[model samples]
Target chain A: MKVVGLYEYLPIEAQESFLDVIVDTPKASGHDLLVRIQAISVNPVDTKLRASKVTVEETPRILGWDAVGIVTEIGDAVELFQVGDAVYYAGDVTRPGSYAEFQLVDEHLVGAKPINLSIEEAAAMPLTLITAWEALFDRIRINPDADAGKKLLIINGSGGVGSIATQLAVWAGLEVITTASRDETITWSKQQGATHVINHRKPLLPQLKALDLEGVEYILCLHNTDAYWDAMQEIILPQGHICSVVELQNPVSMSLIKDKSVTVSYEFMFTRSKYNTDDKVRQHDILTKATQLFEKGFLKTTLNHVLTPINAATIKEAHRMLESGKSIGKLVVKGFEENDEQAN
Target chain B: MKVVGLYEYLPIEAQESFLDVIVDTPKASGHDLLVRIQAISVNPVDTKLRASKVTVEETPRILGWDAVGIVTEIGDAVELFQVGDAVYYAGDVTRPGSYAEFQLVDEHLVGAKPINLSIEEAAAMPLTLITAWEALFDRIRINPDADAGKKLLIINGSGGVGSIATQLAVWAGLEVITTASRDETITWSKQQGATHVINHRKPLLPQLKALDLEGVEYILCLHNTDAYWDAMQEIILPQGHICSVVELQNPVSMSLIKDKSVTVSYEFMFTRSKYNTDDKVRQHDILTKATQLFEKGFLKTTLNHVLTPINAATIKEAHRMLESGKSIGKLVVKGFEENDEQAN
Candidate 1:
C-alpha cells in the first residue's frame, strides 16, 4: 500500500517532513473495516500532532483523521458495514490514520457516506462535523424546542468547526451569534446562517450589548480558550453553558464562573475512541444523521480547497496551509498518485 | 423586629461579632412575602460571610439563609403563598436574610414546609437542599431511569449538601459513593443511603479501585475544589459530569480533564436569586418536590444539633462550631430569647 507518513518530525519546508513509502496492506479483523482511501481533509489537530511530536518513530507515523473511503473488506464481527460500502469517518486518533491508500477503521466509528456529495466534499465534513455535532448536541445537549430563540455564540465562526457549528445551531432553531474579524470571515459566517456577526478582535461584551443581547445561553469556542475565558464568563447567561474545543495553555481561574453557576465542558472528539467508551457507536449514529441532512440539502459541504494526487508533497502543502492559520473552511487531498503504487 | 446581626467583622470570640438589634419591620412588595421566622439554621455561608465582611454597616447586616417561617404578609404579585402558610426557603443573599424576626423573601423562592418535619428540622434543609437539588437535577441533569445504577461520588458525603445529595442520588436509583474520614461521618454517610463510603483524607483512586470501580460517571464535589481537582480528573470516567459547590481559591490546570472530555459545573445556590434569572422559580419547584419526598419518608432531615433562644450569643456559638470544620450534619437555632425583645 502507498502511504504518506513521517519517520521524524520536521518543518513542512524540509524535504524529509513527509515521505512516500510502501507498507504491507493490513487486513480487517474483529469489528474493523479495511477502507480504500478516496479523500482526506487537513485540520488543526493534524498540525498540532505533527508539531508536538517529540520522539522519533521506529516506523513511519501516519497522521490523517478525516476520510471518505470505500470499505473493501469487513471483519466477521462487523454488522454496521459491508464490503463495497462507501463510508466516511473521523478515524481514531490513537491508531494508524488514513494517510494511506488503505486504512483500517472500527465499523462503530464509520458512517455511510452521503450519496449526494462528492468524495472530497464528504471528506471535509467528518472531522469538523463530528466535532461540532458532539460539542453542541452531546456535550451541551441543546434542545431545539425548549431552547428555540435562545442565543448561541460561536467564537471563531469562520474556522472549520465553527462554520459547521453555526449552521447546526441555526438548523436547531437557535439564534446564532458568531464572531469574525475580517470582512471575508464575517461574510463566510453569515453565509453559514449566523443571525449576527461580531468582530472577535473587539471586546465581545460591547459588541453583544450593541446588538441588544445581554448574554448568550450557550457559547461554542473554537479558538484560543485562554484568551476568551474572561469574555465568555462575562457574556454567558447565569446558569448557561460553554463548550470549548481548544485546550488552555495556562491555568485559568475557574472560580470566575462560580457566581453564575456556569457549566464549562471540553469537546475532544477523540474521547470516545481513545477510551473505548460504551457510547462509542454514537459517533457512527451522528455521522449517519449528518449524511441524511446533507442528502436532504440542509447542509452544504465545507470544502473550500482540494488538491489531487494524494502524496507526501500534497499532504505537506495542506499541512503548511493549515499551519498558516489563514485557511478558510476545509482543505482536502484526493486520489493516490499512480506512480506511488510502483513504490509499494 | 428583633434581629441578630453584625455591624463589623470580628472573630467569633468577640462580644461584638454578633449583636441583637431592632430594625423597622419591612413591608412586602412585588413578589415578596413577609415571613415571621420560627427557626433558622447556621450554615458555612453564615460563617464565611461574617469572616469576609470588611465594611462596618450603618444598618445591621443580618447573616442567615435557611429558615422555616410563617407567611405573615404577601405582596400583590405573590401567588405561590398566602398569609399564615408555613414555608421554608433559602432566602436571597442580596436581601436581608432570615436572621430577623420578620424577613421578606420572593414568593418564588419559598416552598411549603414539609408537614412531616418540625420547624428546626425543616430549617436545616433549605439552603443545603437547594444546593444539592440544583447540582444533581438541574446542573448534571441525571435521569433517574437512564442513569439508574450508575455510580456518583460525593466528595464530602457527611456534610450538609453531601448528606442531601447522597439521599437524592440514591432515591433517583443511582449508586451513591461518598467520602468521609471520621467514624461518625462514615456512619452518617451510610445512614444517608450511600452505597460505599471512602476516606477523603486519603487517596481516592486506590479506594475506588478496591471497591471494584475504575471511575465514576458523576461526581458531586462538596469540598475544596482546588484540593480535589487532580483527583477528580483522574477518577472521572470519559464524558462524565462533575458539579462542585466549592469555589477554587487558587488557579488550577483545567486542561487536565480535556482528554476525557469532562463537563465541570459550579452549583452556587444563590445563582438564580442573585441573577434574577428566568428560571428563578425552579428553586420553588425543587423545594416543593423535596417537600413531597420528605412527606413520603424517602428523605430525612439532616439536622443533628440545635441551639435554643436565637440571639447574638447563640449565633456566635453556631458560627464558632461551623468554623471549627468538625461540626456534623447541620446546626440549627430556634426561638427568640425572652429578654432579647427588651433589648430590641
Candidate 2:
C-alpha cells in the first residue's frame, strides 16, 4: 500500500516531516473493510498529534482522519459492507489512519458516500459531519423529529467543525447564531446556514443581548473552552445545555454555572468506538442519516481548499495551513501523482 | 427579633463568636415569608460562612441553611403559604439567615414539614434533602421513572447530604454503593439504603473491583472535590455522569471527561431560590413530594443528634462538631428553651 507516515517529530519546516512510504496491506478480518482511498482531509487532531511527538518511532506513524474510499474487500464477519461499495469515514485514532492507498476500517465506522458529490467533497463531509451530528443530535439532544423553535450558538462557526455544526443546527430547525472574527469568514458562515454572525473577538454577552435574546438554549463550543467559560456561564439559560469539543487546560469554575441549573457536557465522537460500547453502531446510524441529508441538499460539503496528488510537501503544507488558524474550512489532498510526491 | 450572628470573623475559641443580639424583624414582600423559627440545623455551609467574614458588612452576618418553622406572615405575591403553616426550608445564601428568631424567606423555597417527623427531624432535612434531590433526580437524572438498574457511587455517604442522596438513589431503584470510613457511619449508610459500603481510606478502584463491579454508571461526590477528581475520572463508565455539591478552590482538568463523552455537572441546591428563576416554585413541588415520601416511608429523616435550647454556645458547639469532620448524619439545635421556644 502507498502510505504517508512519520518516523520522527520535527517542525513542518523540516524536509522529512511527513514521508510517503509503502507498507504491506493487511487482509480484512472480523468486521473490517479494506478500502482504496480516493480522497483524504486533514483536521486539527492531525496537526496536534504531529507536533506532540517527542520520541523517534520504530515504525512510521501514519496520520490522516477523513477519507472517501471504495471498499474492495470485506471481512467474513462483516454483514454491513461488500466489495466495491463506496464509503467514507473518519478513521480511529489508535489505529493507522487514511493517508494511504488502501486502509481497513471497521464496518461500524464507515458510511455510504453521497451519490451527488465528488470524492473530495465527500471526503470533507465525514469527520466534521460526524462531530457535528454527535454534538447536536446525540449529546445536546436536539430533536430532528420536532420543529421546535430552539436556538443554538456555535462558537467558532467558520472553522471545519463549526461549518458543519452550523448547517446541522439549521437542518434541525434551530435558530443558528454563529461566532466568527473575520468579515470573509462571517459571510462564509452565513452561507453555511448561520442565521446571525457575531464577533468572537469581542465579549459575546452584549452581542447576544443585542439580538433580543436573554440567553441561548444551547451552546456548542468548538474552540477555546477555558476562554469562553465565563461567557458561556453567563449566557446559557436555566436548564439549558452546553456541549464542547475543546478541552480546558485548567480546572474550570463549574460553580459559575451552578446558579443557572445548567448542564455542561463533552462531545467526543470517538467515545463509543473507543469503549466498544453497546451503542457503537449508533455511529453507523448517524453517518447513514448524514449521507442522506447531504444528498437531499440539506447539507453541503465544507472542502474550502483542495491540494493536488498526495505527497510529503503537500501533507506538510496542509499541516501548516491548519496551524496558521486561517483555514476557512477543511483542506484535503487526493491521489498518488508525481513520483516524488510519495517520498519524504 | 432575637438573632445570633458574627459581627466579625472569629476563631471558634473566641467567647464573642456567634453572639446574641436584637434586630428588627423584616416584613414579607413579594414571595417572601416571615417565619418564626422553631428549629435550625447546622451544615458545613454554616461553618464555612462563619469562619469567613464579609468585608462590606458593618454589623453582622447570620448563617443558617436549614430550618423548621411557622409561617407567621405572607407577602402580597405569596400564594403558597399562610400565617400558621408549619414549614421546613433550606434558605438562600445571599440573604440573612434563620439564625434569627423571625427570618424572611421566599415562600417558594419552603416545604410543608413532614407530618411523620418532629421539628428537629424536619429541621435536619431541608438543606441536605434538597441537595440530594437536585443531585439525583435533576443533575444525575437517575430517573425514578425508569429502572436505572445500574449502580451509583455516593462518595462520602455518611455526611448530611450523602445520607439523603443515598436514600434518593435507592428510591430511584439504583444499586447503591457508598463510601463511609467509620463503623457507625457504614452501618447508618446501609440502614439508609446503601447496598454496599466501601472504605474511603482504601483505594477506590480496588474496592470497586472487590465488589465484583467493573465501574459505576454515576457518582455523587459530597466532599473534597479536588481530592477525588482523579478517582472519579478513572471509575466512571464511558458516557456516564457525575455530580458534586462542593466547588474546588483550584481548577481541575475537564479533559478527562471529554474522551469518555462523560458529563460532570455542579448541583447547588440554592441555585433556583437564589436566582428566583421561572421554575423556582419547582422547589415547592419537590418539598411537597419529599414530605409525602417521608410520611409514606419511602424516605426518612436522617437526624442523628440534636441540641436543646438553641443559644450561642450550643450553636458554636455544633459548628465545632462539624469542623472536626466526624459528625455522622444531621445535627440540629432546637430554637429557644422548650417553654421559651413557644415565645417566638
Candidate 3:
C-alpha cells in the first residue's frame, strides 16, 4: 500500500519532512478492521508528534489518527463492524496510523460514518468529537438532560475541539461561554451555538465579569493550560470541574483550588485505547451517537479546510498550516493520486 | 456564657495560649440553631490554626468545628430542627465556634446525632464524616452501590478523615487499601475496616507491588498531598480519580498525569459553608444518613482519645497532643466544669 510517512523528524520547511513510500499492508485479526483509508484529518497532535521525534526510525513512521474509511476485511472476533461498511475512527495511538492506503484498527473504536456528511467532513470529526464527548460526559460527568442552568467556558473556541465542544455543550443545555480572539473566529464560535464570546488575548476575568459570570461551573480548555492556570483557579466555581486537553509546561500549584474543592481532569481522547480499559467499547457508542446527532441536524462537522490528493506535499502543507496556529477548525486531506496507488 | 479561646496565636506550651472568657450567648436567626454544647472534638485544623495565628484579635477568637450538642433554640426560618433536638454538626468556620457554653450554627449544617454513641464519640465523626463523604460520593462521584470489584487507596489511614473514609469505602463495597506508618496506626486502620494496610513511612510503590496490585481506581489522600503525590501519579490507574484533603506545600507537575488522563480533586469539607453554595444542605443530608449507618453498625465512631471537663487547660493540652503529630484517630473533650458554665 502507498503511504505518506517520515524517516526522520524535521521542520515542515525541510523538503524531505514527509515522504511517499510503499509498505506491506497489515491484515485484520482479533477484533481488528482492515480499513481502506479514503480521507484523513490533520490535527495539532500530528504536528506535535512530527516535531517531537527523538530517534531516527529504520522504517518510515506513519502519523495520522483521524480517518474516514471503508472496512475491507474484519477479524473473526470483530462484532461492531463488517467488511465493506463505511466507518470513521480515531484509531489507537500505539498502532500504525491511518496515513496509508490500508490500516488495521480495533473495531471497538470504529463507528458508522454519518450518512449526511462527506468523507472529508466525517474525517474532521472523529478525533475532536471523541475528545469533546469524553471530556464533557465521561470525565466531567455532565448529564445533558439534567445540567440545565449550569454554565461552561470553552477556551480557544476557534480550535477543532472547541468548535465541536461549544455545540455539544449547548445541545446539553449549558449556557456556553467561548473564547476567541479574531473577529471571524468569534463569529464562527457564536455560529457554533456559543451564548457568549470573550477574547482570549484579553484578561478573562474582566470579560467574564462583564457577562455577569462570577465563576463557571465547567471549563474545557483546548489552549495552553499553564497560561490559563491562574485564571482557571480564580474563576472556576466552588466545586467546579475543569478538563484540559493541553499539557502543562510548568508545575501548577495544586493547592490553589483546595479551598474551593475543584476537580481538574485531563482528556487525552486516547486513554481508553492506550490502556485497553474494560470500557473501551464506550468510544464506539459515543461515535455512534455522534453519527445520529449529525444526521439529525443536532451536529455539523467542524471541517473548515480540505486538500486533495493525499500525498507527501499535501500532508506536509496541512501540518504547516496547523503549526502556524491560525487555522480556525479542522483541516482534512483526501483523494489518493492515481499514480500513487500500489493496490486497488 | 463561658468560652475557651485565643486572643493571639501562641505555642501550646505557653501558659496563656488559651484563655477562659465570658461572653453573652448568641441568639439564633435565619437558618441558625442555638445549641448548648456538650462535647467537642479537636482536629489537626485546630492545632494548625493555633500555631499559625497571624493577627491579634480584639476579642478572643473561638475555634472548634466538630461538636455534639442539644438544639436549645431555633431561628424562625429553621425547618430541619426545633427546640431541644439533639444534633451534631461541623459548624461553619466563619462563625464563632463550639468552644463555648452556647453557639449558633446554621441548621442546614446540623444533623441528628447518632443514638448509638456517646456525645464525645459522635463529635469525632461530623467533620471527618463530611470530608470523607464529600470526597468519595460528591467529588469523586463514586457510586457506593455500583462500584463493586473496584479498589481504593487511603493515605494516612489512621488520621481522622482517613479512619472514617476507610469505613465508608468498605461499606460502599470497594476493597480498601490504607497506609499507616506505626504498628498501632496500622492496627487502627485495620480495625476501621481496611482490606489491606501498608506502611507510608516506606516507599509505597514496592509495598503496593508486593500486594500484587499495579494501581488503584480511587485514592483518597488525608496526609500531605505533596509528599504522596509522585506515588499517587505512579499508582493511580489510567483514567482513575484521586481526591485530597490536604493542600500541597509545593507545585505539582500537572503534565505527569497527562498521558493517563487522571483526575485530581481537592475535598474541602468547608466548601459549601465557605461559599454558601446551593447544595449546602447536602452536608446535613450526609450526616443524617451517617446517623442511620452508625445506628445499624455499618459505621463506627473513630474517637480514640478523650479528655474530661472541657476547659482552657484541656483545650491547650489537646492542641499540644495534636501538634506532636502522633495522635491517632480523633481527640475529644467533654463535660465542662461546673464552675465554668454561665448557662445550664
Candidate 4:
C-alpha cells in the first residue's frame, strides 16, 4: 500500500521532510480495525510532532491522527464495528497513523461517522470534539443539566478546539465568554454561540468587567496558558475550575489559586489511548453523542479549509498553514487523487 | 469580656507575644451568634499568623479559629441554633476569632457539637475536619459510593488535618496510603485508619512499589507541598486528583501533570466564609454531617494535647508546640481559670 510519511523530523521548508513510499499493509487482529482512509485533518499536534527533535527512522513513520475511513476488516475481538462500516476517530497516538491508504485502529476509539456531513467535515470533528467534550464533561466535570447558570470562558475561541468548545459549552447551558482578536475570528466565534466576545490581545479583566462578569466559573484555555496564566488566576471564581489543552513551556505557580481553593486540570485528548485506561471506550460514546448532536443541527462542522489529494505536498501545505498560527478552525485533506502516483 | 490576644506579632518565647486584655463583649446581629467560648484549638494557621508580619493594632487582635462554646445570644437572622445551644465552629478569618471569652460567629459557620466528645476534643475537630472534608469531598470531589476501589494518599498523615482525613478517606471506602516519618506518627496514622503507611522522609516511589501500588487516584497534601510536589506528580494515576492545603513558597510548574491530565486543587477550608459565597452554607452541612459521624464513633478527636486554663501563657505555649513541628494531632486550651483574672 502507498503511504505519505516522514523519514526524519524536519522543518516544512526542507526538501526531505515527507516522503512517498510503499509498505506491506498491516493486518487486523485482536480488536484492531483495518481502516481504508478516506480523509484526514491537520491539528497543532501534527505540526508539533512533525517539527520536533530529529529522528531518522529505518522506515518512514506515518503521522496522522484524525481520520474518517471505512473498516475493510475487523479483528477477532472487535464488537463495536464491522467490515464495511464507515467510521471516524482520533486514532491512538502510539499506533501507526492514518496517513496511508490502509490504517489500523482499535475498535474502541472509532465512532460511526455522521451521515449528514461529508467525510472531510467528519474528520475535523473527532480530535477537537473529543478534546472539548472531555475537557468540559470529564476533566472539569461540568454537568450540562446542572450547570445552566454558570459561566465559561473559552480563550482563543476561534481555534480548532476552541470553536467546538464554545458550541459545546453553550449547548451545555452555560453562558459562554470567548476571546478572539481578529474580526473574522470574532465573527466566527460569535457564530459558534459565544454569548460574549473579547480581545485576548488586551487585558481580560476589563472585558469581563464590561460584560458584568466578576469571574468565570470555568475557563477552557485553548491558547497560550503561560501568557494568560495570571489573568486566569485573577478571573476565576473561588472554587472554580480551569482546564487547558495547551502545554506550558514554563512553570505556572499553583499558589496563585491556593487561597481561592481553585482547581486546575490538564486535558490531553490522547491520554485515554496512550494509557489504555478502563474508560478508553468513552471516546466512542462521546463521538456517538456528538454525531447525534451534529445530525440534529445542534453542531456544525468547524472545517473551514479543505485541500484535495491526500499526498505529501498537500499535507505539507496544511502543516505550513497551521504553523503560521493564523489558520481559523480546522483544515482537512479529502480523497486521494488517482494521478498523485506521478508525484511519488 | 476577657481576651487572650496580641498587639503585635512576635515569637512565642517573647514576653509580649500574647497578652491578657479586657474588651467589651460584642453583641450579635445579622446572622451572627455570640458564643461564650469554653475551649479553643491552635492549628498551624494560628502559629503562622502569629509569627508572620508585625502588625500593631490599636485594639488587640485575637488569634484562634477552632472553638467549642455555648451560644449566649442569637441574631435576628439566626435560624440554625438558639441561645444555650452548645456549638463547634471554625470561625471566619475576617472576624475577631475565638481567643476571647465571648466571640461572635456567623451561625452558618457553626455546627452542633457531638455530645460524646469533651469541649477540648470538639474544639480540635472543627478546623481540621472542615479542611479534610472539603479536600476530599469538595476539592478532589471524590464520590464516596463510586470511589470505593480507588486509592488516596495523605501526606503528613498524623498532623491536625491528616489525622482526620485518613479516617474520613477510609470511611469513604478508598484505600488510604499515608505518609509519616516518625514511628509514633506512623503508628498514629495507622490508628487513624490508614491501610498503608510510608515514610515521607524517603523517596515515596519505593514505598509505594513495595506496597504493590503503582499510583494513587487521590492525594491530599497537608504537609509542605513544595517538598512533595514532584513525588505527587510522579505517583498520581492518569486523570487523578491532588489537593493541597499548604501554601507554597516557590512556584511549581503546572506542566508536570500535563500529559497525565491530572488535576491539582487547592483547599482552603475558609474559602466560602472568606468570599461569602452563596454556598457558604455547605460548611454548615459538612460540619453537621461530621457531628453525626463523630457521635456514631466513625470519626474521633485528634486532640493529643490539652492545656488547662485559656490564658495568654497557655495560648503562647500551644503556639510554641505547633511551631516546633514535632507535635502530633492537635493541641487545645481549655476554659479560663477563675483566679487567672488577677494575672490580667
Candidate 5:
C-alpha cells in the first residue's frame, strides 16, 4: 500500500519530512480489521510527534491517529465488525497509525460512521470527541444526571477539542462557561452551546464572580494547562476536580490543589490503545453513543475546512493551518489523488 | 476560659512554645456549639500548624484540632446536638481550635462520642478517620459493590490515618496491600487489615511485580508525595486513580499521569469546615457511624500511648515523640491534673 511515513524527525519545511512510500499492508488477524482509508484529520499531536527526538526508524513509520475508513477484511476473532463495514476510529498509538491506503485497527476501537454524515465529517469527531467525553464523564466524574445544576468551565473553547467539549457538556445538562479570546471565536463558542464565554487571555476569577458564581465545580482545560494552573486552582470549589488534555512542559505544583482537597486528572484519548487496557472496548461503546447523538442532531460536525484530492500540496496546506495556531474546528484531507494512489 | 496558645513558632524545647492563657469564651451563635473540653489527641497536623510562621496575628493563637468533650450549649441554628451531649470533633481549620477549656465548634462538625471507648480513644479518631473515610470512599470514589476484587495500595500504613484507612478498605472488600518499613509496624498493619505488607523504603515496582502484579488499581498516598512521585506513577494501573494528603514543597510533574488518564486527588479532611461547604453535615453523619462501629467493636482505636495530667511537661513529651517520627499510632493527653479526679 502507498503510505505516508518518515525516516527522520524533521521540520515541516524539510524535503524529507513526510514521504510517500510503498509498504506491505498486512492481512487482518486476531481482533484486527483491515480498513481502507477514506478520510484523515490532522491534529497538533501529529506535528509534535514529527518534531520529537526519537531517532529514525529502520523502517519508515506511518503517523496518523484520526481516520474514517471502510473495512475490507475482518479477522477471525473479530466479533464487532465484518468486511464492507464503514468505520471511524482514533487508532493505536504504539503501532502503525492511519496515514495509508490500508490500515489494521483493533475492532474494539472502531466505531460505525454516522449514517447522516460523510467520511470527512466522521473523521473529525473520534479523537476530540473521545477526549472530551472521557475528560468530563470519566476523569472528572461529573454526575450529569443528578447534578444538572453543576457548572463547568471549559478553558480554550474555540480550539478543536474545546468546540466538541462545550457542546457535549451542554448536551449532558450542565451549564457551560467557556473561554475564547477573539470576537469571532467568542461568538462561535456561544453558537456551539456555551452558556457564557470569557476571554482566555485574562484572569478567570473576576469573570466567574461577575457570573454570580464564586467558583465552578469542574474545569476542563484544553490549551496551555500550566498557564491556567493557578487560576483554575483558586476558582475550583473546595473538593472540586480539574481535568486537562494538554501536556505541560513544566512541573505543576501539587500544593495548589492540596489545600482545597481538589483533584487533577489528565485525559489522553490514546491511553486505552497505547496501553492495550482491559476496557479498551469502551471506546467503541462511546463512539457508538456519540454516533447516536449525532444522528439525532444533538451534535453537529466540527469539520470547518475541507481539502479535496488529497495530494502533498493539500496535505501540506492543512498542516500549515494547524501550525499557525488559528485553525478553528478541524482540517480534513480526503480522497487520494490518482497520481499518488499506487498500491503495494 | 483557660486556653493553650502559642506566641511564636518555637522549638519544642523553648518552654514557652505552648502557654496557658485566659480569654473570654464567646457565646454560641449561628451553628456553633459551646463544648467543655475533656481529652484531646495530638496529631502531626497540629504540630505542623504550631511550627508554621504566623506574621498576621499580633496575639497568641490557640492551636489544636481533635477533641472529645461535653456540649454545654447550642447556638440558635444548631440542630444536630443538644446540651449535655457527649461529643467528639475535629474543628474548622480557620477558627479557634479545640485547645481551650471551653471551645466553640459548628454543630454539624461534631458527632456523638462512642459509648464503649473512653474519651481519649474517641479523641484520637476524628481527624484521622475523617481523612481516611474521604480518601477511600469519596475521593478515590470506591463503591463497595464495585471494589471487591480490586487491588488497593495504601502507602504509609500504621500512621495516624493509614491505620483506619486500611481497615476501611478491607471492610469494603478490596484486596488491601499496604507499605510499612519497621517490623512492628508491619505486624500492626496486618492486624489492622492489610492483606499484604511491602517495605515502603525499598523500590515498590519490583515488589509488586514479584507478587505477579503489573500495577495496583488505586494508591492512597499518606506519606511525602514529592519523594514518591516516580514510584506512584510506575505502580499505578492504567486508568487508575490516586489520592494523597501530604503537601509537597515543590512542583511535581503532572505529565506523569497524562498518558494513562490517571487521576490524583488531595484528601484534606479540613476542607468542609474551612469552606463551610453544604456537605458539612456529612462529617457529623460519618462520626455518628464511626461511633456505632466502635461500640460494636468493628472499629478499633489507633490510640497506642497516653499521658495523664495534661500540661506543658506531658505535651512537650508528646511533641518530642512525634518529632522523633518513631511514635506508633496516637498519643493522647487527658484533662488537667487538678480536674483529673473530678473527671472520673
Candidate 6:
C-alpha cells in the first residue's frame, strides 16, 4: 500500500519531514475494517503529532485521523459495516491512522458516509464534527429542547472545530455568538449559522455586551484556552458551562469560577478511543447522526481547500498551511497518485 | 431584635469577635419572609466569612446561613410560605443571616421543615444538604436511574457536606466510596450508608486499587480541591464527572484531565441567591423534597453537637470548633438567652 509517513520528527519545511513509501497492507480482524482511503483531512492534531517530539521510529509512522473511505474488508465480529460500504470516521489516535491506501479501523468507530456529499467534503466533517458534537452534547450536556433559546459563545468560530460547532449549536436551536477577527473569517462564521460575530482580538466581554448579551449560558472555546480563560470566566453566566478543545499550557486559578458554580470540561476527541471506553461506539453514532444532518440540509461541509493526488508533498503542504494558523475551515487531500495507485 | 454580629473581622478567640446587640426588627417585603429563629447551625462558611477580611462595618454584620425558624411575617409577593409556618433554609449570603432572633429571608430560599426532626436537627441540614444536592444532581447531573450502581467517591465522608452527600448518593442507588481517617469518622461514614471507607490521609489511588477498583464514575470533593486535584484526575473514569465545593487556594493544572475528558464543576450553594438567578427557586424545591425524604426516613440530620442559647458566646464557640477542623457532622445553637429574649 502507498502511504505518506515519517521516520523522524522534523519541521514541515524539511524534505524528509514526510515521505512516500510502500508498506504491506494490513488485514482486518476482530471488529476492525480494512478501508481503502478515498480522501483524508489535515487537522491541527496531524501537524502537532508530526512535530511533537524528536524520536526516530523503526518503521514509518502514519499521521492522519480524519478520513472518508470505502470498506474493502470487514472483521469477523463486525456488524455495523460490510465490504463496499462508503464510510467516514476520525480513527483511533493510539494505533496506525488513516494516512495509507488501506487502513484498519474498528467497525464501532466508522459511520456510513453522507451520500449527498463528495469524498473530500465527507472527509472534512468527521474529526471536527465529532469534536463539536461531543463538546456540546456530551461534555457540556446541553439539551436541545430545554436550552433551545439559550446563548452559546463559540470562540474562534471560523476554525475547523468552531465552524462545525457554530452550525451544530444553531441547529440545536441555540442562539450562536461566535468570535472572528478578520473580515473573511467573520463572513465565514456567519455562513456557518452564527447569529452574532465578535472580534477575538478585542476584549470578548465588551463585544458580547455590545450585542446586548450580559453573559452566555455556554462557551465552546476552540482557540488558546489559557489566553481566553479569564475572559470566559467573566462572560459565562452564573452556573454556566464551558467546554474547550484546546489544552491549557499553564496552571490556571480554577477557584475564579467557584463563586459562579461553573462547570469546565475538556473535549479531547481521542479520549474514547485512547481509553477504550465501553461507549467507544458513540463515535459511530455521532458520525451517523452528522451524516443524516448533512443529507437533510441542516449541515454543510466545512471543507475550504482540497489537494488532489494524495502524496507526501500534498500532505506536507496541508500540514504547513495548518501550522501557519491562518487556514480557514478544513483542508483535505484526495486520491492516491497514479503511479502509487497500483500499489494499493 | 437580638443578634450576634461583628463590627470588624476578628479571630474567634478575640473578646469582641462577636457581640450580642439590639437591632431594629426588619420587615418582610417583595419575596421576603420575616422569621423568628428557633435554632441556627454553624458551617465552615460561617467561620470563613467571620475572619475573611479586616474591614470595619458601618453597621453590625450578622453571620450565619442555616436556620430552622417560624415564619412570623410574609411579603405581598411571597407565595411559598405563610405566617406561622415552620421553615428551614440556607438563606442568601448577601443578606443578614440567622445569627439573629429575627431574620429576613427570600421566600424562594425557604422550605417547610421536616415534621419528624427537631429544630436543631433541621437547622443542621439546610446548608450542607443544599451543597451536596446541588453538587450531585445539578452540577454532575447524574441520572439516578441510568447511573444506578455506579460508584461515587466523596473526599471527606464524616464532614457535614460529605455525610449528606454519602447518604444522597446511596439513596440515588450509587455505590458510595467515601474518605475518612479516624476510627470514629470511618464508623460515621458507614452510618451514613457509604459502601466503602477509604483513608484520605494516604494516596487515594492505592487505597482504591486495594479494593480492586480502578476508578470511580463520579467524585464529590468536600475537602481541599488543590490537594485532591491530581488524585481526582487519576482516579476518575474516562468521561466521568467531578464536583467540588472546596475552593482552590492556589492555581492548579486543569489540563491533567484532558486526556480523560473529565468534567470538573464547582458547586457553590450561594450561586443562585448571590446572582439572583431565575432558578433561585430550585433551592426551595430541593429543600421541600429533602423534607419529604427526612419525614419518610430516607434521610437523617447530621447534627453531632449542640450549644444552648443562641448568643455571641455560643456563636464564638461554634466558630472555634469549625475552624479547628476536628468537628464532626454539624454544630448547632438553639434559642436566644433569657436576658436577650425581650429584644425580639
Model 5, residue A335: distance off in Å is: 1.4
Interface RMSD values, listed in order for every candidate: 1.5, 1.8, 1.6, 2.0, 1.7, 1.6
Report the C-alpha lDDT of model 3 over A1-344, residue by residue, as the tens digit: 99999989999989889999999988889999999998999888888888946679899999999998889999999988878899999999888887898889998898999999988899999999999999999899899777987999999997899999998998899999999989999999998999899988888988999988898999999999999999999889999999999877777776658989999899998899998998999989999999999999999989999997889999989998998889998999986887234211
Off by over 4 Å in 1: A339-344, B339-344
Q: Estimate the TM-score of every prediction.
A: 0.98, 0.92, 0.97, 0.97, 0.96, 0.98
Highest-lDDT candidate: 6
Please give the DockQ score of every candidate, comma-separated: 0.75, 0.52, 0.75, 0.67, 0.72, 0.76
**Model 2 alpha-carbon drift over 4 Å, by segment:** A52-54, A142-151, A212-217, A234-241, A251-255, A258-263, A336-344, B54-60, B144-147, B251-255, B338-344
Question: What are the per-candidate TM-scores when only chain A is compared?
Answer: 0.97, 0.96, 0.97, 0.97, 0.95, 0.97
After superposition on all CA atoms, how large is the RMSD of candidate 1?
A: 2.3
Which residue pairs collide in model 3, if any?
A: none
TM-score of chain A of 1: 0.97
B57 Cα displacement, candidate 2 (Å): 4.3
Report the number of backbone clashes for model 6.
0
Error of 3 at B222 (Å): 0.9
Q: Put down candidate 6 lDDT per residue, B158-217, tens digits, no spaces.
A: 999999999999999999999999999999999999989999999999999999999999
Q: On residues A1-344, what C-alpha lDDT tens digit does candidate 4 reach at each position?
A: 87888988999988878787788999999999999888889888888888757578998899989999889999999999989888999988888887788899998898999999888899888999999999999999999778897999999999999999999988889999999999999999999999899999999999899888899999999988889999999999999999999766666666659889999899998989998999999999999999999999999999999997888898889889999999889999877676343212
Name the DockQ score for candidate 5. 0.72
* TM-score of candidate 4 relative to the true fold: 0.97
TM-score of chain A of 3: 0.97
> After TM-score superposition, what is the CA distance of residue B102 in candidate 6 from its true location, in Å?
0.2
The residue-by-residue lDDT of candidate 5 on A1-344, one tens digit each, is: 87778888877777777788889988999999999888888888888788856697889888888888889999999999989888899888787877788889999998999999888899888888888888988888777777697899999887788899888998989999999889888987887899999888888999989989999989999988889988999899999989988766676666658878998898999899889898999999999999999999999888888876554556656777889988788888776665234210
Compute fnat per model.
0.83, 0.70, 0.84, 0.75, 0.84, 0.86
* Model 3 CAPRI quality: medium
Cα misplacement distance, residue B241 of candidate 4 (Å): 0.6
Q: Flag clash pairs in model 6.
A: none
